[model samples]
Target chain A: MDPSQVEIPPLKDLTIENITENVHLINSRCPNPRLKYLMKSLVKHVHDFARETRLSTDEWMAAIQFLTQVGQICTDVRQEFILLSDVIGLSLLVDSIDHPKPASSTEGTVLGPFHTHDAMTESNGGTLSHDPDGEPCLVICTVKDTSGKPIPGAKIDIWETDSKGFYDVQYAGRQEPDGRAVMQSDDEGNFWFNAIVPVPYPIPHDGPIGKLLKLLKRHPYRPSHMHFMFDKPGYDHLITALYLRGDPYETSDAVFGVKESLIVDLKTVTPKQAKEYGVAEGCRLLTYDFVLVSDEEARSLREKEAMTAMEKLGLRMKLLDGLPVPDVD
Target chain B: MDPSQVEIPPLKDLTIENITENVHLINSRCPNPRLKYLMKSLVKHVHDFARETRLSTDEWMAAIQFLTQVGQICTDVRQEFILLSDVIGLSLLVDSIDHPKPASSTEGTVLGPFHTHDAMTESNGGTLSHDPDGEPCLVICTVKDTSGKPIPGAKIDIWETDSKGFYDVQYAGRQEPDGRAVMQSDDEGNFWFNAIVPVPYPIPHDGPIGKLLKLLKRHPYRPSHMHFMFDKPGYDHLITALYLRGDPYETSDAVFGVKESLIVDLKTVTPKQAKEYGVAEGCRLLTYDFVLVSDEEARSLREKEAMTAMEKLGLRMKLLDGLPVPDVD
Candidate 1:
């Protein structure tokens, strides 16, 4: 197509009211219908946010600069954008919509910025924490289905902070992975790990997000929680964390990742039991059950929940719904 | 405030339906009312977008990584996020809202990604283009109030692409400015400069945003144009661009920056006339007039435009309106 053959919007017609429409007009040509809709919805929401806030030019530039800084600081070990999404609750919201279960099946939560993939693999009853400073915790979990069937050969990736409240990756010149490991569920669907009792710790606030939270007079802290990610063939992967029930930040997690079903108490275990559990003194026990959802069930549930979510949000979506939803999967 | 004393949303109640509310509840503690409102609105729209799209986990992660790459690619010169905003028409929408003018005054366009503060200052009728490969263009403009009275000593910063459609800054060499210069309007509000007739050019496409445009089957080319930024004390600073009328990308600018009023035709100047303007052979003359708005007038107009914009966007605002508009200014 000859570019000049396109209809041009006259300057007089490019008023603040119609500018977004004109933008959509140009974007309407996108060949991929799903991308077209995504762009349309994304642009509409973003523009609405700007107009609703009457976002000043300076503020917009500041946002651009802030986002740039967030991106620039990210590395293989660090993802500032994830931290941004976490602090703003976008991560948890996505987790809820994309991978969530309720009732007998366990629900999901934010994967968080501290998760890593290079964890050491171990069999059942593995040790995940190397930090001796933290109180020893024996974590026991059963991988099961909603019908009470054991999910054998399931892989569980878990990580947590030491007493110092820092991930091994957070340290300069990190050596081997510490406070993190992957373990497989036994034939009977049981997986246990001798680990440290994760404690409440502040999210890195020394970065731009920290500065933003500081400006808002908001603290940057996630409640004490050990991260867990479960995966198995034919079952929907679960990305979640178990919060320490009595952690100070439990109710006010900076990332909003806490949930009642996901919070568990840390029971103190005697030295003898700790020895039996193969953990050091000052021991505790963390226990929970993860009921995995099948992929088909998760798909149906996701579709059903999406329908309910439209009305639940109470956000204006009639216009967006009017647009065709391509195969988003 | 003690976090434990705070109310916690029970996991049963923390269904997908009420997660947003819980987030808002947590964010409600933000002492800065403006920041609180901003966060509230921002999170609402973001969550709405996610739910409306039923955005997949993989897609969401892709966006996260995309945004991160955009930020990391930015340097003192490059700003991928700004380009992202520009292509999405957020920049134009913000420009229309932030510093726009209507019938009597000059309407603003995007400042674009090429603008820099290090232009070499020149006198009236000075030359701005040093690239010998481009056809010369003589640019003349007068700065005046809406009443058409001359506003003397106004500063005009102008930049444009060379014949090859590359900004001086885009060159690999770390050299002096080539096609950019600052000029002072004369006592009679007349400012003239010799420059190259800019050609249509593609925005930097090797970055994440470029990849996105490619995925959407959208081209990255912006129309040929000259950037002009005018500033004077007590007057609202104007950032705008004048597009070449017949450029192939005129009607289909990638950034949606082409406006009818800002488009000007370039007339060829005779050899002798080119010398009179101190421009190279095969010269083209570009002419336009800029009408400035004083700070008082601009603020009033901004307020007026903002009110109309709320109605024009046709986005759901009733719910957003229920929230108190803290002193944003």
Candidate 2:
């Protein structure tokens, strides 16, 4: 079909069909095929959403103002857009799609905004907390291949909130990292650390996202969980969090990061049992195993999934010289 | 069904169905019924868009960064978020939906970023341009209601870029408004002004929006047009523009503001005819009529359309005390 032969609809008669067609025509000039496809889909959905909701001019202006405020309040220390995504569940949906792990491998969750490099490296079985007023807890976990074989020299990075549910970064006067540590697994792929039991806490809501939560009448609490990142040579990195079972927000984590496999039971120990771990009596212990996938397998799976997605969108590349260029760089 | 009896899907098994369900549950507590309904629909469309596009994590991060940059660049002098909305065809969509005029009424277009509140008040036939390099042009128009009765004393506010495609605001060293004036219609609803013809120019592309245009391989040009706003006490205000026919970007306006009825002929006048309009010999002339709508009729139509929309969205209010509260505030 000739482009010039197309009948352009008048703006006054601006139906949904006209908006979609006009958007597609303007975006056709996009040199990047992937970007073009995304733009078309974004326009279609945005226009349809407006039509479906019969959004008034006031509502649209309100949205413009809300988005602007979200952007204005964002800084190096805070990301309101990411928080918005988290609350709407878009971040988790993207994560799940990007990291479609095999059944045997550990599942990934949101990479919360609190992560920082330069966590102090601790020896095996060292305590990670310095708070004297908090209840002591011990975590014993193993890192291994999908087949359950021990993987030596694996790096286990761990971080969690204190008993009062505040990450060290959340404190305005903090100068040093607390409740965060990195340790290498023993020869048997085992590592243990002592820390305070994390309590449920609301995400910071003093900004626009918080105001939005208030308007939406939604609570802002995330389930208590310990963040972890496990890595080794020739294996895909695992960025995940382990949630404590029976936490008040476990079923409705504000960030939507809770998974059945990631939720673990916290076993309470008596005074004698606590001494064995060199902590006070009645401390809690958590044990779990993380299964990692090989790098080669992970890459292959991602490529396959991407190809299937492109095909579904009718965006398969045109063949040149009996081969097709990948839509993704 | 009881709320507690609802099954909560694990985040790891977060299908599209699960995300939709979670969003509805989280937003259930919104006090405002209309806002609650709108939130549910917004969440549904946003999630569907992400899923349909099979959006990658990198793409999501890129979007967040883009929005942040647009916001950070905004100031008292510039509005980057509004520019983004314009480029995506959203600003036009909102305007078209909000201002559904009668068949006999004039159409409305974009109120671009260059509008200023301080246009000088000029006599009905006074010249508006101070630029010596521009070709003098004559504009004779009339304002009336849909019943075809002249609206005496109606204020017609007009502004446009000079022939060089620069609004007075676009110049950094200017202290006075040029090529803009406010003229009231005579007893016969007739008004005329002397100004320079507008020229097509690119929308400002020196910011993130500019970078986006380059990435998309799309030009940033708007069709040459004259802006006008008509206001009267008992009629709905009309904000609109008249595009010159044969401009290169008329069919592909960057801001999506062009309409069939808005495109007008720019007749080049002979030396003898120019003497009649009291302009230079080779100046151009444009004549058009704008029909306004009664405020009462416009409000009635808006209320009816809004009700139909709410009914379509299944958002009707439950009756209490033999009366139902309207969905709109």
TM-score of chain B of each: 0.89, 0.84
In order, candidate lDDTs are: 0.80, 0.77
Model 1 chain A: ten consecutive residues of lowest lDDT: A315-324
Candidate 1 lDDT, tens digit per residue, A96-175?
87876857898788888888889999876778887868888888889999899998999899999988999999999998
| Residue clash pairs of candidate 1 | none
What is candidate 2's CA lDDT for residue B129?
86
What is candidate 2's lDDT per residue for A152-269, written digit by digit as tens?
Answer: 8988889888878888887887788888998999899889898877788888788888888778767788888999988898988777999888887787777888889998999987
Clashing pairs in 2: none
Q: For residue A276, what is the lDDT in candidate 2?
A: 71
DockQ of each: 0.44, 0.38
Candidate number achieving the greatest DockQ relative to the actual structure: 1
Residue-level lDDT for B296 in candidate 2: 77
Per-residue CA lDDT of model 1 for B1-329, tens digit only, reads: 33444454432225446767877776776776656777888989988887788777787889888898888888878888899998888888888777857579988888778888899999978889878887777887899999999999998899988888888777787578878899898999998988888888899888888888776666788888889898999899899899878777777788878788888988877898777777667768889999999888887777666655555754333222323254343
